[model samples]
Each structure stands twice: as C-alpha cells, then as structure tokens.
Target: MALTLYIDTARWRAHQQSVVQQFPGIVPVCKGNGYGFGHERLADEAARFGSDILAVGTTYEAARIKDFFSGDLLVLTPFRLGEEPVPLPDRAIRSVSSVEGVRGLVGARVVIEVMSTMKRHGISEEDLPKLHAAIEDVRLEGFAIHLPLDRTDGSDAVQEVAGWMDRLNAARLPLHTMFVSHLKADELARLRQQYPQTRFRARIGTRLWLGDHDATQYRGAVLDVTRVTKGDRFGYRQQKAPGDGHLVVVAGGTSHGVGLEAPKTMNGMMPRAKGAARAGLATMNRNLSPFVWAGKQRWFAEPPHMQVSILFVPGDAPAPQVGDELVAHLRHTTTQFDRMLDH
Candidate 1:
C-alpha cells in the first residue's frame, strides 16, 4: 500500500471524450506532473482523444511526451539564447514570447504568445512590431495567449481576448490562428463568431483531465499507528499532544506534495476569515493535513517528511487501524502518486 491514485477508467475516458467534442480545436496541455495523472499517461490519452496538437511546459517534457503521443508538440516556455532544444521530429512548435525568444529560436517553428493579464510571459502589445521584425528564419505557426484564471467577470473574457486580437491585427502581422487558455464556453463561442477569420485552439488541461472529480481519488495507506495520551511527548519536535489521540503515520508528505500550503486566494469575507484562522494556527506551528480518517480531516502531528506524513487523530474520532488507507484531498499538479490504479 502506498500513495495511490485510484481512477475510474470508464468515467475518465467518457469525460475526456465529452470535453473534446465540445471544443473543435483543443490543444491538450499536459505538463507539470501531467496534472498528477503522469505525463506519459496523459500523452496517450490525448492521442487517444484524436488530438492533433499537444502543449507541454518545457523541452524536457516534449522529449518524453513525443515517445508516446504521435501528435504535434507545442512547448509553452520560450527558449533561451544559445539553448539547444532537444532533438525530436519536426512536429514540435516552440513558443516565442519576446524579442529575445524570436532571436534565440531562429529557424524554428514557433508560436508568439501575446501578453495577457497574467503578464508572467509573452511579448507586450506595444512590442508586437519588434517581435514581428525579429521573426526571421522562424516559421510563425500562430499566436498564443495564456489568460489569467481569475478573470470571472461576466463577458470580460471575450472582450479581453478580443483586445489582444485587435492589437495583433493592428500590427498588420499575418496571424490567423491563436492558442488560448482559461476562457469560458460562452466566451469562446462569441469569440468564434466575432472573428470568423481567426482560428482559436483551446489549450485545455484541468477541464480536460480533472473536470470530473468523481473519476479520480487519492488515497494514502496507513504505515504506522501509535496511541498516545495528552501529556506524552513524541515526534521529532518532542511536542506533547493537546489531548489524548493516536499518531497516524501515513504515506505521502512533502515529497508527494502533502502538507505544503500555497498562498491562499481570498475572495470574500468568509474566505478571509478562514485564512485568518489558518494563519493563527500556523503561527503555533500546528497545521492541518489533507488526510481524512474516521470521517474527519486530521491535523498534522508534525511537519511532513519527504515520503510520509504524521497525522494527529483525536481519540474521540474514529481511529484508523494499521494498513488502513485514508482518502487525501490533494492538488493533482503538485502530488506525486506512487501507484495508479485503474478499473
């Protein structure tokens, strides 16, 4: 028993098929732990979905994905100067987001990413002419834009995407196709009709693989269990429990993305209150764990180790016996599963 991802293959495949049918031209984004489903598995799934182009994060991933997926591979990150991308078939498309990128990846097939609200990468609208001028010996496949995931204001997405398109067209560059991410269905439909001359390829990741949460489950197998009283000292910190409880050592820790908290995105007052509560707990070095045993989420007995974590389960809660597995709610992109069970 270990950190296992139990997947319902039937429902998973059905969801993938259903999602693909909704979008005419979708470039599946399979990168960064392949959203916890493994890159190779997702590459095969993308190919099985009859996709023609697939987007990966880096050249390191393109090499591996190419082995299993017989489709055009699009590398999302811009290549550095004098950096040699891994040699592969001619189906690879490099993303050139700046003047340097245009100059760096000369004589390569590339997609120019326009800067959206994300602003992490891509060339600015004002610099489109500079990028256009720098495009020599490189084949401009199309334009690319990574939208911010937080843009949930009604039809703002459609307007935002149009703004980029307007800028690109104003530059008088011969761009017709665009690769985009994080747009709603209605926004996409409106954009299609608004710009019939332009082709939009949705670079979908989360909605494609993890849209149906019921199809996937993360479970951590109990490795060790020890009963303790309120006054007993244990763990590396030698801290005593606040009350009588059982120390549940389970598989999956920091190495598997357990107990690692990313900055929370506070939307409104309720979420802010919850964040404040968690912050108060963090100050005491007491954190919560994602594992659920006895029908309740457990707290961390101590900081998570590399491959496993220690969970503190209150005595009043249902205690998990040794070898029992607990369901762990995890961020798929950050987690590394030890086993992938399919049925």
Candidate 2:
C-alpha cells in the first residue's frame, strides 16, 4: 500500500564492504535525505562499517545523526560567521573555507578547504597565507578539496589535487591529511604514491551506498484500477482519457518525489535535443510515469497528487490488480519511500 524500497541486504552490505576495501580511509557521507536511506540508517551503517568519521552536508545534519554515529562528524559545508552554533562541538569537525570562518570557529575542530576547479566553495590560493595565519587558534584537522565529476575539459583531477598539495607545501601548511572527493581508484593510488606523507580519505556518498545497481528495487503498490474508454473524464482536474485503458492509482506521488525531475546536465547535442522533445511532450500532456507495468512505462493520466499517481495502462497491456506491485524506475537520491524491506 505504499512506495517501498526493497534491498538485497546481503548484496548491499557486500558492496559497501568492497567500497571500504577499495578506499582504505573512506569517509562515508550521510547527508541530504541520507541518499534516500535517512540519516540515522546510514549513520548506523557507518558505525557497522567501523568508520571513524562520517561526513554530512551541514551542521544541522550532524546534529541529527550525532547520537546514531559514535564517531567524529565532518561537516562538508563550510561554517560561516553568525550561523547557528554547532551542536556537540567536540565531536564535530567543521569545514572552513574562509579566513573569517576560521576565525569564527576558533577552538573548534576544522578542516580548511582549498578552492578547486569546481569553484563552488573553499578558500582561494591567494588567501592561503591569510588562512594559514588564521588557523592558529582552531584545531586544524587537515585540508579538503571537492573535485568536479565531469573531466571532459582536459583537466585531470589528480593534477588539480597535486597542484593544491604543491601550493600547500609551498605555503608551509600542514600536509598530514587531505580529504578529497570524485577521485577514481587509480587516481587515488597515483596521488598516494606521489605524496607518501599525506593520508587521503575520499568522502563518498552515491558510489558507496548505491554502487550495486542490482542490490535495490523500488515498487509502488496498485491501490485501485478503473477501466476507462476514450473521452472518459477522470482525475482531480477531470482530465479525459485519450484511449481505452485502465487508470491505475499507484501508491506514490509528489510527496514521494514521483513525477519530479532534478535539473540535469545535458552535455551532448543529442541529449539536449531529446530533453527538448521531452519538454515539448510534457507541455502537450503526454508525460510518462515511472511505474512500469507489463514491461513498459505507462503514461501519467495527470500530474501526481500528494500521495498517489494515476497511470494510464492502455487496453493492449495487462493491467495490475489492486494488490499487485508495479516496478518503478526511480532516482534513489530524490525518492522518499514509505517503507524499506531488507531481504
């Protein structure tokens, strides 16, 4: 009677163990809906994995999962002045990207983030000296750099990381530890070989929990089924049926992140053209739903409601019974499931 996430528990745990083995010092990231597993669940998993540190997106997230994970919490979002005071300051290692941030979090555990090519956050190289001078009062855990995922611009992530290492060395800053993201296994290995003194811990989220594609499944239970003919009015907006079909009320909707799309990066011309075609179809009320019945994705009768979606299954296709579950292709990061079953 709900949108459920079913997990192959053994396989999922095996994948997590493999990731931990691949990245010797990995910081499991549990933030932003906890990658659809919730903060406490991932925090417990991190504890089970024996991780000494867990990375979260914000101080608020750290506070939420602090009790669940008994290790140090690394807040990836840089702490700024006048922000809400961090909870459990002793166990929280804040990421500081500015001199003011360093000054603001004086006497707190902090990691100084140097700006990378991503340019989202972090202190610039020009201000490295100022950052160096400002970190005297805080417990400087180490440095961190968030790398860009797209490497098509001829810029190598390893080179970028090494460049920062060289700059930090020149600045006479501590080179004991570095936290990095988006580095491949071989790239991390090369960096480790280049700098034997530094311990590089990769902060990973998606690849760690969602690495095994076969280890998870999503299903939406059929709540009701109504046979309809062409021109039959239905749904909240009284939308007419386009053809003979069965209107399926599935137990998933806007509240569960159904019929919602996050902004995507369309790199190639073909992708951009296809995206435009999808948008054009959506404007004409031909939007498709994620629920798959009889091995085909069905069309949405209308926009999803708060707790249910109506899918139009054409007459030719076999319709699901009220108790049957329809397999759904969903983006786990954005989805909020009512229940998770471990098998």
Candidate 3:
C-alpha cells in the first residue's frame, strides 16, 4: 500500500520555467516535510530552477538537505541556548529571533526575523541594544522580518512593519540584507524603498515551490476492491457500505494525518417555520470534508487514515479495478508518503 504524489514531468517542467521567468533570484523554501515531496527532492528541483539559495525550517532539517543542495542553506528555526544535541551545519545561515539567540549566534551568519502575527521571537525595540552589545563580538550578517498574512482591513500589516522599522532604526543595526516571508512583490518593493540600504530576500514556500494549483496532482492507488453486501460490516468503525457496490480501498488513512479535525466558523442562522405548532428551527450543519475524489467535484469522503482511505466510487460511472489510481487532495504537511515519481 503506497500513497504517493505522481508528478507529471512535462507539467512540472513547465511550472518551473514559468516560476523562474516570473521571479528572478528566487530562494526556494524546502520546509515542513517539503510540503509533501520531501526536502531533498525539493532541493534537487530547486537547483534545476537555478536558485542561488535554499531555506530550511530547522537546523536538524538542514542536516538532511545540506548534501542534496550545493547552494547556501539558511535555517529559519531559532537556536536555543541550552537545547542539547545542537545542530551546527557548515555553510548554513541561522536566524536569531531572540536577544538570547542573537547573543548565542556570535560569529555565526545570522538572519534576524521580526516575527509578526506571532509575538514569539525576535529582538524587541527595547531589547535591540542589549542584543547588539551581546553580539558585538560576532559578525552580524543581516536582518530579516517574517511578514504575516494580510487582513481584510490591511492595517495590521502596515502597523507591524512600521513598528519593526522603527525598532531597527532606533537600534542603528547595520543590516546588509533582509528576508521577508508572506509578502507580495509590491509590498516588498515599498519596504525596499523605505529601507534602501538593505537587500531584501523573500522566503516563499507556497508560491515558489507549490505555485500552480493544477501543476502537480496527489493520487492514491486502489489496493483492494471488493463487493460488499449492505448489511456487511467494514472499516475501523465497522461502517457498513451504504449501498450494494464495490468497496474501494485507497492508499491513505489516519496515520498519514488523515481523519484529523480542524476548526470552523458558524453563520448562526435561524430558519422560521411557517404554521406548524412550534415556530422556529435552528439547524447546525457544520460537516467538514477536506478531500474530494477525481471527476466527481461535489462528492467527498472523510479524511483517510495513515495509509488508507475509503471513497464511494459510483458503480454507474466507470468503476476502478484493483491497483487503480485515484486523485486525493492531500494535506501535505501531515502525510509521510512512500515515494514521489516524476511521470
């Protein structure tokens, strides 16, 4: 039973070409399980795109991908003081997001990320002086700001960035380069103009790596197909097949980040009943289906388990045989796949 992302080679090549042509000097971000295809493969692909540098999520993540790529690897995760088994990958740039981290990164090439949307890391406006003094012995390579997602109002983004710039200006930090995450080209251009002295690096994962929606597809293979009676029991929960048809088993299940849950918003609408005794009805139908099968856009099944998922392949339509492949909308971060082959 294998769950995989089968890459259409021609489509992938076209995607790469389009990306490179659009964005020059792109830093391919290979992080968080490489968004499904694994870090090393993403690195190899990034090299083909002619990316001068690559960004990894953590120091440990960097170790695995360092050999796969020849370009400079920058670690986005922070380095703590007392965390044992510290990762020190050669030819890698580390991001120091805290005063302590900056102090610890003495003599190391570090990127300072002023994190927005989360107040977890980075040297604050008040603490920058202390950080500067602590890192006086070390060479400060550059500064970076991890941008947040834009809001409906668009004021949070502007305010946070302005505050970050104010802090940087107050500290008089000699920043040679800056890296921004989740920023648009126009937004980045505006920032660059404001801070004309520094070089800006856009650390993109979603756009740079998995840019096009239809460029690549995630498919699951039908391992077993058996006709089950309506009363017959199946699955972990002993769920009986609704109708008399082939019970198609796919290569996805709970262990692969499937069957997991998430939060949702409620509209809180109350329907008014016309003339029957009572008067009002409040219905709460908040069922969430994260995945859909191929061809049938409206039809959807629940998240699959680690290595298997069950989909209702209609008998009226073309039925799949054993070992038949079907498309799956995969949550890339949660899945540990068998392999990905370029077709």
Candidate 4:
C-alpha cells in the first residue's frame, strides 16, 4: 500500500530559497502534519533552511521534531492551567496567551500573545497588563500576533499591529522579538523599518511549504482494479455499478485524510452559487473525487473507507491497471502521507 507525497527536490529547495530571500529570519511553521509532509521531515527540512527556531502546534508535536531538529522549539498553543501539563524541553518557548497561562508558567521562557483580529487564540489588549503582572518572575522572550488571512495584505492590518505595539509600549513591557502570522512581505518590511529594535519572526506554514504547487505532488498506488458492468455490486458497501466501467481501489482514504476537506473560503455570491450547484450534484451520487487517471477525475463508488478509496471510471474513459499509480489533488494540511518520494 502506498500513499505518497512526491517531491521535486530541486524545485522545492529553489522555492524555499526564494522565501528566505524574500523574508529574512522567517520561522518555518512545521505544524499540522507538516502540511502533509509530516512534522519530523519538515523539521529536518527547516534545519536545512538554516532556521534557529521551529514552531509546532502542541508539545506532543514538538517531541518528534525536537529529536530531529536541535533548534529552539516554540509551541504556538499554550498549555492551559487546568489541563495536565506536559513538561516542555528547556529550549521550548511557550505562548502565554492569558494571565492564567503566564501565572501557570512561572520562570518559563514565553512569548506573550496579544489577541489579534483573528480571535482564535491569545489575550485581549486590555489583558496584556494582567499578563504582564502574572509574568513577574517569567522570562518573557517576545510577543506574538495572529492576523486573519483575509486582512493580511492591506495597510489596515499594519495600523492594527501598530496599535498593539502602542499598547505593549504603554504597558511598559520590554520585548525583543515578535512572532507574527499571515503578514505580506511588503508589510513585514515596512514594520521592520518602523520598529528596528524588534526582530519580527514570520511564522509561515502554507506559504513556506506548499507555496509552489509545481514543486510537489501527491500520489497513491493502485491496489487493485475490477472490471464492472451495469448492476454489478462491488466495494465494502456492495455498491452497484451505475454503468459499464472499472472499480479502481487506491491506497488512500479517511485514515489518510482522503475524503476530508477544509472549509472553503467563499468570496462572492457567484462562488456560493457554484458551491451550491456542486453540492446538489453530489447528493445525486456524482460527487467529484480527486484521484485522476488518463487526465480525468474519477468518481467514488461510495464514501471512502479507512485505508482505501474506490473510484469509478466511465466505460468510454481509460482506466488505470493494478499496480499503477494515480495522482490526487488534495488538501495537504489535513492529509497524512504514508510515503514521500526522493529526488
């Protein structure tokens, strides 16, 4: 069985070089299954990028990456006070989002996160003073802010960040570095020029790894293939064939995040209408599957299983044979690839 992420190493490294050139001192965020490349591998890749610090989503994620990466590990999400505390490595930098977090982590090196417009994590601007008070004995490493993706490109976000800076200054807290996400290159440059004393560490994940679509590919092995005719039953659910075609089973499914999807960013009314139309078609058993063969996307005979997906090929269209490979266009962040191709 094979569920792989094929790499164009030359092109991938080229893109990484371009990113480092564009955003100096960029912290490559190797979290969330390492954008489908796995965190351990991404940590190794980040080390090759010459980064001193790597950020993971949680402490458990840090253990594996830390073993491979001998750099400072920053866990973005702080361990709450009530939960069972996972002892962090000495090099681990925690994000103290609230006064509770700061109080809980006394003497621990931490970055105080002021809540951004994103509102996913972090404390509010008013709570900064409370956080400042709680971290009296804490080694405050820096500050962190997470900006919403939609507002990442504009000048307003810069002004918003400036407001946070003003609040931090007013609180009389001394900070050196700042961890920021979803800021444009130009915006970061502008901020750097404005605040020369503070080192801005751009926490980048998607734009760092999957930024160049042409540099990477996802593939799965063709485990088996069966010729099916109209009314012939197949698959675990014993789904009957709608027409004469082939039932192709590939080595990727729900376990590997094959049938899973992230929320789509809907822009306008037209896009919403298109999505609705697609949803209607999917209700009729014509759901579009990502597995591609002979330049055409096949349909799933039923819902994806734990470790494999069954695709239906049309009678007129060409089908993949057993032991063949097929490319899958999927969401990397949610996917878990069982294999990765070498250069």
Best by lDDT: 2
Measured with C-alpha atoms, the lDDT of residue 74 in candidate 3 is 88
Highest TM-score model number? 2
Error of 1 at 148 (Å): 1.4
Question: Candidate 4, residue 182: CA error in Å?
Answer: 0.7
Is candidate 2 or 4 superior in lDDT? 2
Candidate 2 colliding pairs: none
User: Which residue runs of candidate 2 sit more than 4 Å off their true CA positions?
Assistant: none
- TM accuracy, model 1: 0.93
The digit string of per-residue lDDT tens for model 4 on 1-343 reads 7989899999998998899888888988988778888877888888897999998988888876778889999898876888766766899988878888888887898888888877877878768667657878788888889888785355487787878887888888775788888888998998888889888889998998899998888888999988999999887778789999988999999998998877788988999999999899888877878899989888888888899999998789877888888999988888888888877
Residue-wise lDDT of candidate 2 within 1-343, one digit each (tens)? Answer: 9999999999999999999999999999998999888898899899998999999999888888887888999998898888877657588999989889999887999998988888888988889888767888999999999999988879889999999999999999998999999999889999999999999999999999999989999999999999999999998889889999899999999999999898999888999999999999999999989999998988899999999999999999887899999989899888999999999
TM-score of candidate 2 on Cα atoms, chains taken together: 0.98
Clashes of 3: 12
Model 3, position 103, has a per-residue lDDT of 76
- Candidate 4 ranges with C-alpha deviation above 4 Å: 152-155
- For residues 38-93, write the lDDT of model 3, one tens digit per residue: 88788988888778789998888888888899888888887778766556565788
Q: List, residue by residue over 79-110, the lDDT tens digit for candidate 1.
A: 77777648877899998777887887768898
Residue 145's lDDT in candidate 4:
91
Instruction: Enumerate clash totals for all models, in the order shown.
Output: 0, 0, 12, 0
Q: Alpha carbon lDDT of residue 185, candidate 4?
A: 92
The 10-residue segment with the lowest total lDDT in model 3:
277-286
lDDT of model number 2: 0.92
lDDT of 4 at 63: 72
Error of 4 at 24 (Å): 1.5
